[model samples]
Target: MLNIKYDIVGSFLRPSQIKTARAQYANGEISLAELRAVEDEAISDLVEKEAAHGLKFVTDGEFRRRWWHLDWLKEFDGFTTEHLDIERGGVINHIELGYITGKIFYDPDRSHPEIEAYDFLHKEAGKYPGITAKKCISGPNMILVDNYLQLGIKEVPYYGSDVEGLIEDIAIAYQNAIKDLYAHGCRYLQIDDTSWTYMIDEKFLQKVASLGYKKEEVLDWFQRVSTKALEGRPEDMVIATHFCKGNFKGNPLFSGFYDTVAPIISRIPYDGFFVEYDDERSGSFEPWAVLKGSDATFVAGLISTKNPELESLEDLKRRYAEAKAVVGDNIALSPQCGFASVEEGNCIDEETQWKKIDLLVSCKDFI
Candidate 1:
């Protein structure tokens, strides 16, 4: 029999106080230091709640940024903030591309944002010493997507000035970032990635085909990039890849099935894969066999945060069982995504968010 372990993928569940502080920061009423104080208090409360819920792997809930991962990377170099194009979605980003600290950090020129968000995760984890602390970061490839296309930077870097160099730097930077978190005693890492979804998009797919690449070739690209980022890391490190379909406000950017890119998704292995199977928009779970790794674990997203309706335990269990039918029993449970991928959060409130996690905890037998 497979030894099934249960855990939940972590994300920021925004609190009311943090929202007020954001307005204060906007109106110039609170200095950055003051803002930090408010953020600290919110994180303290969030950590307490997770403890109350008995979650073994706890996160600060990504409270640091206004957007999902982009907001968090304001600390990196070669980036700057700018007026966002209304059509292209993004969070608060480093203004230009000059501040990139490397594949993982910024230059020691004191250019990095002096925010304590990531470390705050350490503080809360230490407080609960009983639960494992998880740190979430945008997957390496996703950073490349958000940086170049969303911001409309057409120029290439001189180091290589092409896709190859770009991907290498992303992997390198992630390693550095992971090292920093590990030094602070973090044992779990989840890379939030939406790149695969983009690859399967109609427009982007046409763009790749325009370059004379075959469908199989594009799929290989996803596997290679994802694998490159996972390369040469500590075997004991609990690294997970989140297969997301974009979360902005309560809106989603794309959706499809794992079969579209099954070859690579299944081959480029990781300890666990966090996937969305909450609705048919994600198609059937048939491709999960492709995602199956030897001794590999899976976090089945049976609870959805997009809608406010709290899924019934019976209904959630049915969904979990459906995934098990294909992968044959190596499955876990979590919401399709965070209660709040951005500041506004997924169309739900704190009450509903807790109810969702509570459901996961309640459905332990299925998980």
Candidate 2:
């Protein structure tokens, strides 16, 4: 088994300027050269801040991508954006609120439409000296999940023909993207697969089951897409998967434990797993115990990134003790989810975010 010292899910929140630059460049208002300059400065600042906190692993905060995972697919060669009417999620018991339908392409239309987006983020994060940078990719299964659900997508974007063929092309496109990211020194690539956890919800499960899929078939769907997309990658390099029901609107989509999905997760070859445990909705420690004797490092989500209210030292310690008892000291901790899973910051403001970080540092020894 691979043993690691210290317990840190090291990464940071993205800065705002990168978004501004991407906009200006996309609208043809500024040259790509100008955007690169902005990205360079922004990435440098991001690295410096992460290092200042004494973080061992760092990310560029996904400085180049707009949405965390989807945008990476946009960088693949066979992808094109086409709008299809996809569903929007609700608040609590997060359901499909509505659809902000528009045309989108399935292609990687951003920049360098050859491979994946992670290596570029990794490269940007690498520019900073001395910090071990990380790259986060949208899990291949995530894109397939979005396609299958037709989530938030509008039907007919700029790619007006051959829809079925295009979907197959997308899967192939992602395969190449994953390979390219691996080639570029991405020893620490985290596939952001939050969608899988959302699948265990009763409402959604009922819907998919209505489509004629049984429990075994649905479980196979999860394993097939996830493992196939992750196939043929390097073993020594770490590839971790993260799942939270949903961080939108301070509402969660499902309230179940790893007990439901742990069997599927344990069978996968991923080196580590990160899960949310910040609220009662997340269920109990038994979810992780399923991976007993497994090498996968479980980063328990003991802290909440959505609410500004800080988790007191005592409470966090107690939570960790419980997790340690169940999963042993192999567990690490991170904010329950990304502070900004989408553009809007979580209910928490920037100051509270830093305070939480300070607490994480204070308890480094306990880790």
The alpha-carbon lDDT assigned to residue 59 of candidate 1 equals: 80
Whole-model Cα lDDT per candidate? 0.68, 0.63
* Worst 10 contiguous positions by lDDT, candidate 2: 93-102
lDDT of candidate 2 over 122-233, digit per residue (tens) = 6655656765667776665565456545342424344444344444444455556555655667677777776567667778777666655565555666676677666667
Candidate with best lDDT: 1
Root-mean-square deviation per candidate: 3.9, 5.3
- lDDT (tens digit, per residue) of candidate 1 on 1-367: 1123555656656778888998999999999899888888888888888888878778888776776666655656544454443544555532222223233344333433323465677778777757777777776665555554444344544433365665666566566666666665667878787778777677766665665555665455556667876666765677777877877776777766767765577666667778877778888788777644456677788778788887888887787787887776667777788777778777777788888778778888656
TM-score of each: 0.86, 0.80
The lDDT, on a scale of 0 to 1, for candidate 2 is 0.63
What's the true lDDT of residue 311 in model 1? 83
